[model samples]
Target: MNLEEYIKENTATFDAFLQDFLSINLTNHSAKLLEAMNYSLLNGGKRIRPLLVMAFAQNLDIKKEYYMNVALAVEFVHTYSLIHDDIMDDDDFRRGQLATHKKFDIPTAMLAGNSLLTWAFQILSDESTHPNTEVRNYLTGFLSSSSGHTGLAYGQSLDLEYQFGNKNADYKKILKMHDLKTARLFKFCTRAPFVLCNPKILLNNKKTEHLDIFGTNFGLIFQATDDLLDYRDLDKSVDLGNIMSYKNNDEVVNYCKKLAKEALASLKNLEIDSQVLTELIQFIIIRKS
Candidate 1:
């Protein structure tokens, strides 16, 4: 299938999966907390991160059921990050709706975010996620490191520091922050399939290294596009003083295209058909949202 068609089909399946996976008993004492969590978890963002996991796994002949929880774990971590990020950034809206903190109280939103973060690991650790205990442990470690202090959290910290303390932050510093904050998780999304099927592939295979590099570029493209979109939304001229040092919209767009090309190139050595991944790279650059 074509990329758009593939994404449409998988997005529907993943959304349905999320609905059932996130369902909580209304009569429970923490029903309100569960409600807030569900509100944000079910928010209609393009499920790109989870889709990446599935896309990468597909090439390895992995069944969707085998990797479904892994994909969901990525989404949960992503959602948790969003909830906390909205709170920290004091953002009122997300995906064109009230952010978790705004929809619910700050404390409720915080707890929901925390709960999702914890549950990501919980899902990774569950026996139903994978038959092999070693594989589950590997995934647990991978998810933890990707979302914990050295990965997403570190990136967020750098971003906050730059926004509040380092008005003169340069392009390199900003890129490092983005890599940690954004690219690390994408790295996991793309590479974890290898870890699941054969952990040694990641350790010894050159193609696996290429996949990791692809994810790194993908993450950069995702974040750069976001910055460009934000600039467009604000009707602001491109400013070098901004977090990224792009001189104009063309520069940002060109950079995204460059990253997409690099990402596509990285898949050249893989034996599997990677048309969906190639299209995804292209889609990342052109996506409006």
Candidate 2:
């Protein structure tokens, strides 16, 4: 199948799975909170993280039941981050509609995000996620490190600091922020399959090291393209760790190209069919949204 066809089919399948898994029939005092959670969780997204999970696991002998929960778990944390991020950034819109905080109240949105965040761990801990307790525990710990203070959280703290404070961050610091904020989760997405399928490949194994490099570069490319797309609306006077702040559109595109090359290079020696992932890197560079 072609790239577009692959994306469409996989996205639809994953959406269905997510809908089935999160089916809610509540009418209590917390109904609104659940409503808000569903609103943002089911909100239209590219499902790129989930796609990464499936893509990496494709052609492998592992069952969907083994790795599918990893896909859902990533979206849970990702959606939670978006809801909270919209609040922190004070943005009024997400995916061309009212952000959660705007549709509901800040408290409701905050609670919804928290609920999703915890739900990710809860679902991953279930026996259905993985029969082996060790794999389930590994997935949980990995996600925590990816989304917690030393990763995305610390990156957001730096974002707020640089956006509002007097300190000036150089390009290196900005890149580090990108690694922590964006690349860490991408790393988790790409690495989860190996953890689920082959328990012997530890985090420091060569296979995982290459996967980490690919994920980190792919994430940097993804962020650069996002910055390129959103550069128009940003205040030119402020530097928000966006590569666009330091480079023009053409330059940012070139940077994405460079990162894409590194990402592809990281996959060259891996003994798996990375064709879809290779195409995905190109797709990310050119995507308008």
Candidate 3:
């Protein structure tokens, strides 16, 4: 299948959805900060986290609108993290645009980052965002915990330590840092819809645990692919972890693609609409960035 075609199609639709959602012009104190927050959030990326949310929700039989708020909110959290990350790492570019801190200022970026963080939860908690309280509650809690200290924040700590630590760090330890810093939220993005839509299906409902396993495995594979992408840049600027001395990104990416295939293999037995998601897994594995 043409995985690039699949992702390009879906991302077009998803980007439009994000624009429409942002049209709401929702606000809180610190209007300028909120504007900066919107600037970064709307600034482009692969939109992988949000896409995973939508893709998995579709598998669960939920449509685009049903998951739009959750997906958009997920993107918000992601953009906020990237903003502060660029500031902390002192990197100057993101997705080929000026890093948030540089585009604005350090303090402004910090407030803007905080602005997006709160807004993400606001979208989840907004009564109008979801049709049912149960779904809303599950999403709110899941996203919160994942982006909180237990996941993204702690991961950031690990990443900072590694930047100053060693380029040739143990592979296993590097994996841990990537997981907390990069994978945890990815884990959240892929699993949230399934869990929110049907916790029982995952936890105790014997009806379909395979999908849960599929999502978890899929998450791991996606995380690895992301790490591989960062390492692809020989300069290692986009990459947080110190990688092998340059020139082996091809081997690394191929290995990651293999892992992705294994993850998709786990879904072969699940009963769900996986047409796009199946393609998505492969697309992520092979994507350039």
Worst 10 residues of 1 by lDDT: 237-246
Better of 2 and 3 by TM-score: 2
lDDT of each: 0.83, 0.85, 0.71
lDDT-best of 1 and 2: 2
- The alpha-carbon lDDT assigned to residue 196 of candidate 1 equals 78
User: If candidate 2 were superposed on the true structure by all CA atoms, what would the RMSD be?
Assistant: 1.9
Clashing pairs in 2: none
Which tens-of-lDDT digit does each residue in 1-289 have in candidate 2?
A: 9999999999998998888777742344358998998899878988999999999988566789777888998998999999999999999999999999999999999999999999999888989888899989999999999999978888777766665643577677778888888889999988889888877778557878888888888888887787777776777776665666678888888888888887787788566666789999899999978
Candidate 1 on 228-264: residue-level lDDT in tens?
Answer: 7777777354343444444468888888888887777
Clashing pairs in 1: none
Against the true structure, whose TM-score is highest?
Answer: 2
Give the TM-score ranking, best first.
2, 1, 3
> Candidate 1 regions off by >4 Å?
24-30, 235-245
Model 2: residue 194 alpha-carbon error in angstroms? 0.9
Model 1 global lDDT (CA atoms, 0 to 1): 0.83
lDDT score, candidate 3, position 221: 60
User: Against the hidden reference, what TM-scores do the models get?
Assistant: 0.93, 0.94, 0.84
Clashes of each: 0, 0, 0
